[model samples]
Target chain A: MPDTIAPRSADAATPPTPRMSGVGRVLVAVYGILALAATGRTAVQIIERYDEAPVAFTLSGLSALVYIVATISLVAPGRVWYRVAWIAISFELIGVLVIGTITLVAPDLLGAGTGNPFGRTSTVWTLFGAGYLFIPLVLPILGLWWLAKHRPAPETTGASATSTAVTPGASGAAA
Target chain B: MIAWFAGVQIAVAVVGALLAIILGLLGRKPSDLTMGPLILVELLLIVQVVISIVAPLVGNEPSGSLLEYWVYLISAALLPIAGGFWALIERSRWSTVVIGVVCLAVAIMVYRMTQIWFVQGL
Candidate 1:
């Protein structure tokens, strides 16, 4: 069995690491939902009343784009995708923090003034996502942690090569 | 929207969330016990959709932005289906928790929907 499986591993090379397994799947599920939500909010804000708060609506659109990218990157396979996930999630964290603080301290800057035509301008990161229960603030942190934990094995490393070579045989045996 | 029906949906969603979370804490994988509540929530959401369509025609219109109300309702309906698919693919304790979280979110969204229908007008 080992002889047959070892040859198969060599032929297959290193199979792309499973990023969407176990806890990561849960992360992706949350990300997908957030992506859907941000996109929906952006659509409504921009299409319904873009003129009322252009800056705030544009910011909402930007967050929607970020969420969509992050969701896809987290689900895609390969090292390139892993790097993309890192960049997108990092940007999301920064956006949430910066926007959250701004919304809290000087919401008028985002058109949250009482006299504004459309109540307060809200986004996914508004007030650290108070409207959405702060999930926006927390999700990127969790995503960064998940990415750090699931770093792809270095392809050039002899040790990693040996481990990858061993995995298939073990899986084959379990099968 | 009928007040009692909305109240019942919220109650069921909250109960479902609590049940799923408890099962997850016990380290239980995806099972009928975990999925049942989510399915029930989905059914209630379908009912909610029907009500949303018929109520406005019957002179019970939402006071808020109609687009906003429908978007929230549609998004709320999708959450459970997505969570259930995740649980089916990855049968784990965490997936159970995900279902719970989704249910809780649905409850909140449903509450918001009621608020839109009854109070807020744009």
Candidate 2:
């Protein structure tokens, strides 16, 4: 079998696979792995030593939550789930940048006598998202790219233009 | 030792990644590698897991957080197995991406394992 799975071309009358295919599939798989990673780390912190760095530990928990949501959204089928995954991914991007920066220059704030106030700040975002060698940093960029690959319809001229009027270059009044 | 084993793992990952690249260039999809080298990588992972589980019992802790080290090991082993399955089902350029990610992940694990194995810092 060729297994090309037919990329969603403009010619296609039927909609593309509602669920992930191609790169999206692997993306989801990575999310699943990261979910496992973050979940395990957070569980360990909470159960073994919650007092060591509560702030860092809390962020780990939050990241874990985001990863779990992303993973579930990635694996499950449907438009609603896709939107949820997008939301989780967006939050992941924000979390990594914000937390990564905070832990980097403001080590004194997130750090502790134990060297980690939030239960040993071991999050995907800490240190400019270096924990995953910046993949935590790059994932959002790739996500947006993958989302773009779907080539959602131009919204400016659509009947529901009110919803997406703000879309870039939507106003074709001059044209 | 897991550290030594990691070096070998990296070597294997590089090879797997290269194969994925070559196959991708040839218009071969992820499904092409599903039953071939991909399975071999999974087999290597199984061996890796066994060695990792047994390593601590037979020897002293490497140096860093042993739990953390094992976490990397366990997850590393699972990467290709799950990734390969997903690739098989999806069968797109993404399979090549999976191989790339696995290679990257293994390299990172090797680096972390090295840090824990040799370094004493937190």
Candidate 3:
């Protein structure tokens, strides 16, 4: 049964939505900026002053890694990339919430106390991302919503019929 | 960073953001009107990069960490390019808004760069 219709349906159901289109483009752009910002800041912090705040710098590196992964996953094609996007974004949200709370509750634990040389917190998630206008806090939530809204079409069981029905409508709306 | 040049860059970015936001709210796609200011912002950023290279040689060294200032400046310069490329590819209302957001981010980043140069001394 699966082999019979695979040829025709495969192309149609290959990718339900291009994740890099329309509003997703904006999301990707923002994610790209955050990735660049985080990576650059983390590199500087870890390279120049790792001894001063190892914990904070490490977390910053983690956040940068997550952002870079999320950005790439969002732009990639196919179901595996989609799943990766979900995992990365979910982790980002959790990281932001947990790190934000930690920074707020105990800044010293992250080496954000007066003992720090920079005289300010530096993590991407510090104080709920206040340093970045709280975009870090909000971005993951938005990413999750986007993922949920744009889930790929199931590839088995009535795949062709549903995909054919949905494709025109999606294209029409986009147009 | 020259004080007046930084101020001009911020002002241009803010105005560019406002223009893009207005165009986005109007449901307009990425057009000349929406992209023009962004191009100007990118040009200003290019000028900024050149100035950043030249300013210190002329005896106007930043009081802050040179690494931090350069990182901020280079990162800020990249925003407009990325945003403009996204606008060109997407060519939608949201792309315009993204440009607006990028412009706003650039404004803030430039201000930060100025702070690092003039205020945050090592």
* Over 4 Å off, model 3: A1-16, A112-121, A156-175
Kindly list the per-residue Cα lDDT of model 2 for residues A1-175, writing each as its tens digit: 1222234433332545534665566677667767877776678667666787778778888888988988887666555666787898899888887877777767757646322222244666777566665777787777766765554322234555554666556556545
- Model 3 Cα displacement at A66 (Å)? 0.5
CAPRI quality level assigned to candidate 1 from its DockQ score: acceptable
Predicted complexes: DockQ each: 0.48, 0.23, 0.56
TM-score list, all predictions: 0.83, 0.74, 0.84
Clashing residue pairs found in predicted model 2: A53-A116, A53-A117, A53-A118, A53-A119, A54-A117, A54-A118, A54-A119, A55-A118, A56-A118, A57-A118
Clashes of each: 0, 10, 0
**TM-score result, candidate 1:** 0.83
Error of 1 at A169 (Å): 41
**Model 3 CAPRI quality:** medium
lDDT of 3 at A75: 90
lDDT of each residue in B1-122, candidate 1, tens digit only: 88899999999999999998888878899799889999999999999899989998989888877788888899999999989997898778989989988998899888878877887664
Which candidate has the highest DockQ of all? 3
Worst 10 residues of 2 chain B by lDDT: B32-41
Per-residue C-alpha lDDT of model 3 across residues A7-51, encoded as one tens digit per residue: 534554655565666678778878988998889878887878888
